[model samples]
Target: MGLLDSWTAGSHTADGLTYPTYRKGSGPGVIVIHEIPGITPGVIGFAEQVVARGFTVVLPSLFGRPEGPASAGEALRSIARICVSQEFSLFALGRTTGCAPWLRSLARRLHDELGGPGVGALGMCFTGGFALAMLADAPIAAPVLAQPASPAPLGRARAADLGLGPADLASVKAKVAAGCQVLGLRYDRDPAVGTRFDTLRRELGDGFVAVEFPGRKHSTLTEHPQPEGVERVLAFLEEKLTTKPET
Candidate 1:
């Protein structure tokens, strides 16, 4: 059986789109969107940690083989496919992916079923900024963007867009004003993640929590797995999802 087979497997239908999903654990809800190469071992490992931390983690397999091993060949194939897929805006600046609405619906359903303060979402690699995009819905209390490398990261415009259109960007900003904090992670020298960090800082101000690492490693939770990053993410999730006595 695939590693995903060990998790509860199902399908979610949202905004007339259906996708395979995996879930494990119990508590508040957290949607963990995988990178371009799908639900690879490394991504699964990260999700397992989230589950162990007491959140019901939901992973939607957007591309690549579900629960596949992380390999250069597979990564290249997934990248090529994503480059041509209309569901994603490979080189478009300031436009959300076609998949965003569907993801937003999924987040709403997860929050409706497993409520706490709200839901947490972590999007990595090509889908990184998706956590931000999902903020169009109000239930996303904590959004984590890890190495959000989309639009091929080619030019300044693409680097600054954060894969969001103007209206969605407005919604995200409004959410920040409502006390929904966003967490971002990237390497100091990863060309895949251009100046979007600066954009986020400027756009969200104190609402943006940025964790920058030295060198060129990408994929904070998977591929390059940083222990500190993992801990920071978990702490952020706990802070947002846990219920505290009213002071």
Candidate 2:
């Protein structure tokens, strides 16, 4: 059977952009942005675990083949396609990717339907930093950046930039100041992540919670889903998304 075997499939359109989405489970909404090269088997596995944890998980098919397995050739092909796609920011520095707006809209809509303090969003690899950008608009209560590798991590400027334009950066900073916290996880030796985590610390200060593992692993929840990293992510989600008892 395929990775997305029993999941319900559909498409979400916002701000003139549409992409396929798979959903499962129940409770608060959590949008799982798949890594580049598409929704691979490992990503599907992680999504399933999220579902098992009681949250309604929505796996967005942003790039690559949604049913593709995680293979080197598939990853390279997807990388080539995304590098040329207008939806991503493969080279631009300090500019949010074009796909961010669509994602933000989707998050708002999901939060509205789900009806909670807000919704959760977890982005991996090229899409990792997207959750931070999504925070500019409200309703993203839980934002996780797992190994954000965008703008190709080619230089210092691109390496540290979260791809947020000036205005969006200001908005995100405001949210952080207002007490919104973001979770980040990455391998200590992953070059693709650049120094973005350092940038997060410098900019967000205590608002950023970073969990670093000691290794060269790149895909935190997919290619190599570390037990500790997964536990941290799940606990973060529960803390942020779970409702508190009335006094």
Candidate 3:
């Protein structure tokens, strides 16, 4: 059976873009954007954990085959497709991915239906910075970046880019100033993450809670699977989305 066999499958369309989504559980909503090579077993396993933690989780298949295995071959093929896709801003510095609007729309829809403080949005690996971008427009009270690798991190400039444009960055700053906390998890030596964490620290200051593990591992909540990182994410989501804010 497929890894997603038990989850309810659906599709979301926004800004003239459509993508399939797998959903499960019941409670406050949390959007789990899959890593490269799609929703592999590892990704599914993590999502299941979130669901078990009492979240209505939605897994968006941004790229790669859903339920596909996480092999190097699959990763390469997905990377090739992502590089050519107009939806992602892979090499562009200081620009949000074209798919951000669609994701924002999905978050809004989930929040509107659930009617909580707001929904949680967690993006992993290549899509990691997306959760931050969504905060510019969506009611994403909880934004988690798990090993965000974008803009390719090729040069010094790209390495420090937050994968957000000027306007989006300004909006995110405003949100942070208003008390929205962003949770970021990564290995201390993960080259794929580049210096985006440093950028986030500079930009968000104490608002960005960074949880760094010690190692060269990537994919904090997935393939590499750091238990502490996963628990930190769940706690952050619960605090931001379900807990009432002080008046």
lDDT of 1 by residue, 159-243 (tens): 7778988999999999898788999998889989888899999999999999999989888889898999999999999999998
Clashes of 1: 0
Tens digits of per-residue lDDT for model 3, 1-247: 8878899999999999999999999999999999888999999999999999999999999889988899999999898998888998679987888999999999999989998999999999888999988999999999999999997889899988999999999999999999999999999999988998999999999999999999998989989999999999999988887866689
Candidate 2 lDDT trough over 10 residues, lowest sum: 82-91
TM-score of each: 0.96, 0.97, 0.97
By lDDT, the candidates rank as 3, 1, 2
Please list the residue runs of candidate 3 whose C-alpha ends up more than 4 Å from where it truly belongs after superposition. Answer: 243-247
Residue pairs in candidate 1 whose N, alpha carbon or C atoms collide under 3 angstroms: none
Which pairs of residues collide in model 2? none
Please give the lDDT score for candidate 2: 0.88
Clashing pairs in 3: none
lDDT of 2 by residue, 1-247 (tens): 8778799999999878999999999999999998978898888888888888989999889878888878889989988888788888677888888988899888988898898879999999888988987888758999999999986788789888887888888998889999989999999999999999999999899999999999998998888889899989888888999898899
Which has the higher lDDT value, candidate number 2 or candidate number 3? Answer: 3
RMSD of each: 1.3, 1.1, 1.5
What overall lDDT goes with each candidate model?
A: 0.89, 0.88, 0.92
TM-score of 1: 0.96
